[model samples]
Target: MSLRYFDNLLKSLYTVARMNEPAKPDWEKIAAMPEFQALLKAKRRFVVPCCIFFTIYYFSLLYLVGWHTEMVKKVVLGHLNIAYLFALSQFFMAWIIAFLYTKKSSKFDQQAAAFLDHAGFKK
Candidate 1:
């Protein structure tokens, strides 16, 4: 059989399986769970600081380029100027944050699994 045919077959099987599964938990029940609350708190702790830092860091570049054009144009190394370097640094900063978030998200997944188990729900 073709790959596309197998893919469609699998999708139909998945839909059938989903239809047979138990109902999802209510949102209120999930919200009341201590483990779920801890998950939210943990996520906030990691996410809020990263967001604030990224916003300030990104905007500072714009502010400097717009208001302090001469400072931004000054050569930092070889022919590369401060603006070029700062803009380049943004790419690295984004990659670093994504890496960190990926690592942290695994922990969040674990927490979510534990919460599911605690709630007597099968994954």
Candidate 2:
């Protein structure tokens, strides 16, 4: 092949590689954005409370299981003790919280997308 053809091939490969790469966000601009700040605040508002509540719930359950054996052993259903129910409920609670967070985060994603588009970050 001619040198000219080789140069053209290299340029074409470089162009294709660059095209496939995602554009990097301007971190300085993103950090300075009011929308981004609001996103952080909104995320914290949901997450902080969730963390606090779950921490309390988990510790209380642990305490009850460790210190209140009689209370935890009391049958609530057909041979299902309070401890058993509480243990099982932890799985359900986790799933429910995860589902809720997924639902909530979609809204945040939408808002973030809009903000990015407004800031000329989206292609």
Candidate 3:
């Protein structure tokens, strides 16, 4: 066996080892990036208001059901009462919120991908 052969084998092994290991992003550096900060701010701007609105809307239903029983019990449709309609509206509300978030997150993801590229991180 030649010394050059052993050196080549070692090099091949090192290369294989590196290829098997996934590249790790530097969280601290990523966090420090202005692009990342802007992404977070943008997400916060959307998410905070959605969360606040959803919470208030949800609690208001509970409040109406618990305290304003007469109001909620009033018939709005042939069979559906205000409470039932309100409860049903929650499902639609959740779906709407989810749809909005999904739509918004795609933009966020694009921004994040750009951020990663700018930061020299592999996707």
Candidate 4:
């Protein structure tokens, strides 16, 4: 067969496949729900501040390393410089944030479940 015929066949198959899929949830209704709105608010309350804090922290480290190398070089430990400590602390900071987010997300999950239950969408 020709390339155009093969492309048309694929397009028709894709359309059929999409048509067979189940209906999606009504997001407008979900968004209007109080529980869903609260879940979104909770996420924003945690995430936005955390993101801003981390951005400032990461930039401050960059600024120190870039323009204040002499200060960062001062040894706080036996041989490790302040820069090294700060760099290592970034990893720990990420882990701590992730741990806190995990804890916070459990509450969001409950809120989501409640929304679904209220909406009669729970399976």
Better of 1 and 4 by TM-score: 1
Weakest lDDT window of 10 consecutive positions for candidate 3:
21-30
Write one digit per residue (lDDT tens) for candidate 1, span 17-97: 999997886989778899999999999999999999999999999999999999999997999999999999999999999
Rank order by TM-score, top first?
Answer: 1, 4, 3, 2
Model 4 segments more than 4 A misplaced: 1-26
The per-candidate count of clashes, in order, stands at 0, 0, 0, 0
lDDT against the true structure, each candidate = 0.96, 0.89, 0.95, 0.92
User: Whose lDDT is higher: candidate 1's or candidate 2's?
Assistant: 1
- Model 1 gets an lDDT of 0.96
Off by over 4 Å in 2: 1-26
CA RMSD of all predictions: 8.3, 5.3, 6.1, 4.9
Off by over 4 Å in 3: 1-29
Instruction: Flag the better candidate by TM-score, 2 or 4.
Output: 4
Compute the lDDT of residue 88 as modeled in candidate 3.
95
lDDT of 2: 0.89
